[model samples]
Target: MNGLRKGSLVTVGTGIQLINHITHEAVQSIRNAQKVVHVVNDYPTQRYIQSLNPDTESLNHLYGPGKPRSETYRQMVDVIMGHVRSGLNVCAVFYGHPGVFVNPSHAAIEMARNEGYEARMLPGISAEDCLFADLGLDPGSNGCQSFEATDFLVHHGGFDPTCSLILWQVGIIGVGDYIADGRPSGHIGILVEVLREHYGSDHEVVVYEASPFPYPIAGPMVQRTTVGRLSEATMTTMTTLYVPPLATKADRDMLGRLGLGAPQRS
Candidate 1:
């Protein structure tokens, strides 16, 4: 048992853009790994990764119609760990931040650690990061709340409407399995209903998709629409829902407790 220790694992994110968003540490991991398994969107990015390491392979074929994405993710973890257990320095790369809603990367890292192998995840630019930049939002000012679109629909309670809200994976509600043709998401109307309880039907919301390219080259696409019209809006796989803050009065009681006297409101 003592002699069985072998291999190492590192998970990295290439981010949303081509080469602009990837971290230097992530590129080094890809360059030095004995094996690399990745799932990226375009052929140009794929070729770049292959150029970094000839051992690079893609896990895109694992997805199919009628196959649960959870199953595919589990298979990805298994494949990544398989290489790690075989005395190879394995790199698993995903499109966005490796730990942000990336189940397989987290799972593989946990599995590798449990098996007594070294494993870690490197940070990369996520859509949420781009969202703040493109929208000119300072989350520090008003605070922010984030959740998956489906989970927010069913389980969100006590959520403050005065703070900014970010709903991820808005185009894939009620979708548990992979769909090959990439059809429009079906349950958006229900999502609108849930949000309407907090924000009125006329409350403006942004249906946003951060562009894969950097700003000005091809900027982030932002569509400002009311909550009522969100159901009618066209959504793709990358769409995210941003619900801006509503008006709220400041709590004078809390302000006094903090020893800060009431200042003039801006």
Candidate 2:
């Protein structure tokens, strides 16, 4: 501890689609780091990281069948911090935006900073970013609400039906463990039940997954179905459910208070 050089940490994301989606800054961080530890969704990304720096290693081995995801995240933090404590300039890579739905990346950064090591995170393209682009939806058009599927159900907070709703990890709701096959949890039915309370049985929803490859190679998966048939739809670990806003009218009272006339209908 006394003789080791000062350690530092930087976490970055590869984005949903590799190579193209990843920022140059993130790529340079991976290239310059003394050690790189990553958990990417696809094999192509893994190879790309290794190509950037031969010292790159995967954190995927930490995940095991039936292992609690929380435990795996803890172990990942430990490993990343271990490298930092050894006086290595460590780069931690994740699939999506490092700060989005990634527990270990945040934990490692916090630990590194607390232990007097320089640590920071860089932003990357996220699944939601791709979703917005692929679906031609603008959050500013109405409003947007996002939630983890289990949290949406467990917390039971009322959401706006007049605005868009996005539920992430819908395929794995209520699943706390790592499954080898990326199986859908049985709890999705519960999510359907709850969503129906807000959107109704006949409300049309989209089940979407961003393609790991670029458009020419593979397009994003977009499945349209009614809320009533959601339980019967195929869902995977990466699926995100999009519930569009219902028909909504502007509040004339509020518009009048602002001294503005009613918004012209398009």
Best by lDDT: 2
RMSD over all Cα atoms, model 2: 2.6
Q: Report the lDDT tens digits of candidate 2 across residue range 176-233.
A: 9998897899987888788788889999999999988776759999999999999988
User: Where does the lowest 10-residue lDDT sum fall in candidate 2?
Assistant: 257-266
Q: After TM-score superposition, what is the CA distance of residue 211 in candidate 1 from its true location, in Å? A: 1.0
Which candidate should be chosen as best, given TM-score against the real structure? 1
Q: Return the lDDT, model 2, position 208.
A: 98
| Alpha-carbon lDDT, every model | 0.88, 0.90
Model 1, C-alpha of 207: deviation from truth (Å): 0.6
Count of backbone collisions within predicted model 1: 0
Identify the runs in model 2 with alpha carbons over 4 angstroms from their true place.
1-5, 215-217, 264-266
